[model samples]
Target: MIGLSLNRVLAVLIKEFKQLTRDRVTYAMMLAIPVVQLTLFGYAINSDPRHLPTAVLAQEDSRYARSLVSALKNSDYFDFVAQARSPAELDEMIRRGEVQFAVTIPGDFSRRVARGDQAQLLVEADATDPSATSGAVAALAALPDQALAHDLTGALAMRGQAVKPFEVIVHRRYNPEAITAYNIVPGLLGIILSLTLVMMTALSVTRETERGTMETLLATPLEPLEVMAGKLAPYVMVGLVQTAIILAMAATLFHVPMSGGWLGLSAGIGLFITGSLALGFLISTVARSQLQAMQMSFFYILPSILLSGFMFPFRGMPAWAQWIGEAIPVTHFLRVVRGSLLKGQGIGDQWRELAALGAFVCVVTALAMARYRRTLD
Candidate 1:
């Protein structure tokens, strides 16, 4: 009896292995995803921000200005890359994406300090990306005092005068703390939703088609819209469950705070899931088989991962890359999630992103319904 039972179990295991090995795509995914995910996350995910390109616009060639520039160069965080003769040159460098920050020292910087009058150092930072900007600002803040002290001691030795009345105040408005998690977690929400919903819907739809059940459903009295709605309703519920799980994990495990109201977060998640599921339905309509559906889903997932603000700050990317990101629904959803959760912004602040998501849902839903009807016919 024991020998017969063991033989039966071995036969079942062998059959299951054969079935799994038959699908080349699934076999590759099973082995490749872990390695790919590990490598991508290991090198690309950097919580410590550095190497911010910085420019100096010094009108004064005095000891104080030169000293400040030297101090900036010595710091690891700021890369002293360019020297701008005028504000226009500095602005041009920043706009042209050559430099992330610029510092200007007035012509009378040394003269004012020697005479006991107040000397001000002007610092300009690119506020396009809040995370990079904060790092640059913090590095700049620590430099001026050290530079001024060196300048003061040298000036006293040369002209026999005391060093006083020098001030360096930092003006970092957008993101003061340079909190990496605050910037990334919000973007991650969009990515998590997209991956879960798209994969789930794609597999579910393809499974029905593969099993020859979709044809039976089409033969029923239900319209395409009704069928699509029915197919999506269950996943929408699953999306909500997944959203809650993710939110809890983010909060408890990662210490990611949610500053927005629960209702607003729920609404945003619903819209995002609607858009993602619609996209999945569109993918299902075009794909001929389950393997094809997963392949198409992967094509979508790769670009979204790279181009979205989740991996890298959108402003840091070149203009063409930024334009590509704008077309993705995940990009807009990230903006909404980040603004609400990290910035403690309300619906009014995120209306533009919300509108973009609404537009995505409308467009994708229309396409899915049209394609679904054709499939039924």
Candidate 2:
């Protein structure tokens, strides 16, 4: 048995701690990532979304109609963002994601209420992301009583005391049954691709450099484009295989609907994969080792999951965080994947996201090429 040496053990412990502290990036990540991610995600995530964008279709100028709308506005769940002139306009707003709820007050709402009759208010909710609108839908129950509370007086007093004075016609669109998997399975594609492709490529160049193979490669007449293509091609293939597997699993296990044409979906996912590879290549230029590459990749993981509409509604986040999410490649990719898979959106419908991914690839590739050392000096 080896003899225990207190002094030697103490010396080793101190040396290890010093080395650990010297690794600023690792130490900062250890301290900051957990705390910051927890706090940030806690505040950013809301199962019950508040101040949801709402469209009002008021054909009547009745005080009662205005009061009912006011009640919804005051409840902190709905914010009247637009006024739709027709039912078709309101439905279009919901489809385009311009608004979450469309409140339609029939022209005779005030007349019905004046006669102590139950007035019907149609609230059509874009429930594609059911979690976002559930709270607001539940909150609508209190509106009828609250709307009539002050308005009912003298002969109209019976309306105030009625158990239910108005009917809230809730039309939950998209996932009408409010399926959770409908939202999650599509998002997993982005998250998985980000983890595998980004982290793998992030370490690719760094590993070669650390092993001194980069020096040998630079001795050859290979141009940067050749080198980049050689390194990226394998990962791109891997990404496609992974994409196929995930999509199959999503369809079979989660019953995720894949609605769009295969060509459009493949094009979008292909662009996303290319962009992720470029981003990882850029990270590889900055990272000195596999551990550093992983740390950098891990730095993005939380933000991808939390801010990219994966764990929560994207529009639910604050403006600054939304801006950050918008800058991330996964955010755009999620839109492409989800829109194509869920809504049957083609390239014409999702061209902007594909273009954004293309732009990301260009920018990251440029930065990576600039940072990549040709001479390995």
Candidate 3:
């Protein structure tokens, strides 16, 4: 029987460390993932996001209107990005997600305020992501009391004394109830597709290489593109089935609305599935083994989950983080899914995100083919 020998234990420990150092990809992942999580959680993520994009439609250039706008900006929750020419334009901006909020002041705002009449300031918010808007919405509660304090001074000081002053009518558009499932269920399609498709495709391809079957397969007359197409075809079906199941559950169990038509949703899903499979193929080409492929896939998946606005608000991230998120296919896919399911946006409305997903597919497929060709040579 082997006793607990210190010398043998020390030898095994040193051997394990040597093997760990030899596996550079795994070693690097261990160190990098923690740092990535720390940096993302510490600096990039913000729950109470400030300076959200806001559109203004001031029908009158009155002092009271200006005061309200100033108060909104001063609250640090709203940043006026566009001056909407009409109500239609303002609604369009909110519909297209150009702005998180829209403020509309009536033409007779000052007249009514001066006369101590019930003046209304309309605030329309895109509440698709409830957490993103809750803080900003709460900030509005205090605005009516102080927003007009300066303007209501002098002869109109009595006007400010009214219990509510002017009414701030906030219209929470799209998911007025602020159901969390309404946001999460649609986004789950992207996150699940990313984790499963990428990992499965990468592992499958790399498994063939580890088992020495890749060389035999490469001996066939099939072209690189044809081989990749064959490898990815089954996974595409898997992705489709997964999407159908998730969406069905979302609608039936969660009662999440499917506002957009199937055409736009199908287009987005197809592009995303193709892109994710291609990305996995690219990773497989880069990885020397199945373990390496799995490790690399985790590297990609972590960022997708964190930066894609899946677990956090996308707009809450810093500019640099948002730029990085833009490059990830999952980010655009989330927009497409959420837009279609929640906002009922069509192809015309979500064209940018669809285009981004298309670009990802093209680029990744091209890179995968190139890398496979290099491996063949």
Candidate 4:
């Protein structure tokens, strides 16, 4: 009896191995997903900002302005790329998002200094992205104290005037404290939702298809929309539970404050969950088996993580990369989440983001419906 049981167990094991080998998607998940995730996280994840593009709009064209420009260029924080001749050009560069900072020197900078009048230097920086903006501002703030002070001392000696005391006040609007947690927590919401909702729906739906239950369900009078809705309702509850857990953890453990109203935040989360579930339903329609659904989910998840500004600041990425990021729904959702939670921005403040996300939901849902209809046919 023991020998017979062993033979039966071995037969089952052989059959399972054959099935596993036959599924290319399973083999890919076993082999490719780990390596890809590791390489992406290891190389791409970094908080330290570097090589920020900066523009100098020097009107002085004097020795002092040249010295200041030289000082900025020598520093590791900036790349002194262009010189703007006028405020219009400077404004264009900043508005076009070509440069993160524009260090402007007044035409009478040297003349005013010679007469011992306090000369003002304008350092206008882009504050759209909190992290890169902070780094650029910090570097610029230090420059006046270090380089300007030395230059002022030399100018005093040249003019035989005494070095007068003055205050260097820094104005950091948008995100004054440069709080990293404030920036990261909101984006994390979108990422966590995407991973959980998308993976769960994709796997669960595919499991039904793999087990032959999908055919049984289709035999019922239920419409495709009804089937999709039934499959998604349970995962929506799961997404809500996960969102609560993450929000609590973020507040209590990480001390990240939620500046927006809870109602608005909840609404945003609901929209995000719906969009992600639609994406998962779309994936399920494309995939024939559970393994294929999982692989396809990973492909979606990878881009969402990398290009969504969750791991890296969006402005810090190259232009081509930024364009790629724009294609992902998580990118728009992150902007809404972060802007609302950290910046205390209301719907009016982020109407653009809201519009974009709404459009994404409409587009993805329509595509999912089309795909689902096709699959049923």
Q: TM-score winner among the candidates?
A: 3
Q: Model 1, residue 112: what's the lDDT?
A: 76
For model 1, residues 212-231, the per-residue Cα lDDT tens digits are 89888777787878878888
For residues 306-326, what per-residue lDDT tens digits would candidate 3 score against the true structure?
Answer: 899888888899999999999
TM-score of each: 0.63, 0.91, 0.97, 0.71
Write one digit per residue (lDDT tens) for candidate 4, span 301-338: 99798867787877566566677778888987887776
> What Cα-based lDDT does every candidate model obtain?
0.71, 0.84, 0.91, 0.73
Candidate 2 per-residue lDDT, tens place, 226-290, comes to 88889999998999999999899989998887776466678878888998888898899898778
Instruction: Candidate 2: give its CA RMSD in angstroms.
Output: 2.3
Question: Which residue pairs show backbone clashes in model 3?
Answer: none
Ranking by lDDT: 3, 2, 4, 1
Better of 1 and 3 by TM-score: 3
RMSD of every prediction: 7.2, 2.3, 1.5, 5.8
Question: Candidate 4: lDDT of 312?
Answer: 81
How much does candidate 4 score in TM-score? 0.71
Off by over 4 Å in 3: 374-377
Q: How well does model 4 score by local distance difference test?
A: 0.73
